[model samples]
Target: MSKGERMKTTAREKIKQQQAAQRQREKRRRVVTYAAVGVVALAAIGGGWLYAASRSQSEEAAGGDQAPVTVQSDGSVVMARSGVEKPVLDVYEDFQCPACKQLETVSGQTFKNLAAEGKAKVVYHPISIFQREPTRGNSLRAGAAARCVADGRQWLAFHDILYKNQPSETVEGFKTNDLVTWGKEAGVTSPDFEQCVTSQKHAQAQLSYADKVIKEQKIEGTPTVKLNGVALEGNVAFTPQQLRDQVTKAAK
Candidate 1:
């Protein structure tokens, strides 16, 4: 219990206390570093999400006109996705598809008026499933012939008549020889028209297009349609009234 010994012991204790304090300060520094790292990570994730959303909007706005589909060789009878500002309908229909015929019959002038006024744009995707050879009402033959009429500036007329008299699965609506007669009804006069109908050159294009559409969009049935590329109920028929409602809702 000498005073010098007591002083030495106290000094050792003081050194131990100082080391413990330094350890605590290092621990605090580490805690602060981890907290700062977490905050930075959260901010980065938030920024990435915002950037992706903004880029999507920019791309949507920059969407260009659809490429002109070749219903005609002159590049005139062009069918495409209409880029008209509000309430554009992009419809996929087969010329021999009975459902499509029904829709056209129901929405005929109403649709025509909408197109004429530019309030709506109707993009008809003429698919050829129901028109094939022999039982040739709903297959490639109808589609190619439609292209023939469309090539000469009678697209609308051809569209209407073809739908109106859509031949049933058993009966080909208009005979091949009768195409010349039908062309006159659509205002296209060509001795060459019959030759084109018989030529079957347009079949190559139609088949290629149908294959492309099926692969890209995953469409399964006839009259598959989309409003702004959003697929809807395909098994049943939809009326014009329902279509109008969908257009309004989508625009909103």
Candidate 2:
């Protein structure tokens, strides 16, 4: 072969080798990029799984057939005797509701007195209706923590504490730590109760129960009071004395 032809042939072979090397480098780079992305995706999924499992475990630990509070078929929490002969008062309230706070302040003691006297049975259904932006699920958190308090048999006291320390509606209140602190103040010294409150073990279940009650009862707002299956018109429709009168009448 001619020397020029030989030179051209060698140059062509060198160029082919360079192109193959470049292609291999690009392929390796793509593999590395895909591998990194896969790792990140796996990490995110694993983290989510771990979080979900932790929540599930906490819920399992907090729930049982012997729970202190009554869990209805629809998940409502009932605070009264199952077959009490006294007049029944069903109170549906949200922890984040200012109106509920007023109602509690106005008639909480009255209701407690009636219940203690066997004149009436108060069934407190802690529903969550104030779940919105900025509040960041404060109502749900409070409701769930209230369940934990109920488990500790301090529902009424903790209920009062929550309302007394209630914050404004425009911000996130009733954080987990705050709830734990309030539970302690309300005589909930059990470590299990503290764990339940802090971990929000029943948060999802509480929310589900609230949703079920809201849908079934068509509850549009908080502080809905039903006395012997009759709904009250408003907060001031019946004063504490009048409520006591009605309960006395119903018991007859």
RMSD of every prediction: 14.7, 21.5
- Give each model a TM-score: 0.60, 0.66
Model 2 CA deviation exceeding 4 Å by range: 1-83, 150-152, 236-238
Worst 10 residues of 1 by lDDT: 56-65
lDDT per residue as tens, model 1, 153-218: 366677777776667677655566665567678887655767777776577777777777777777
Tens digit of per-residue lDDT, candidate 2, span 1-252: 999999999999999999999999999999999999999999999999887554332111112222233545443555544356457888888888888898887677666666655567777788888656645488888888887754425666788899999888888789889999888888886679978988898888888888888898788888888888788764432367567767888888
Note the clash tally of each candidate.
4, 0
Clashing pairs for model 1 are: 130-138, 131-138, 131-139, 132-139
- Candidate models: Cα lDDT each: 0.62, 0.74
What's model 1's lDDT at 149?
Answer: 63
Residue 237 error, candidate 1, Å? 6.4
Q: What is the lDDT of residue 174 in candidate 2?
A: 91
The TM-score obtained by model 2 is 0.66
| Candidate with the greatest lDDT versus the true structure | 2
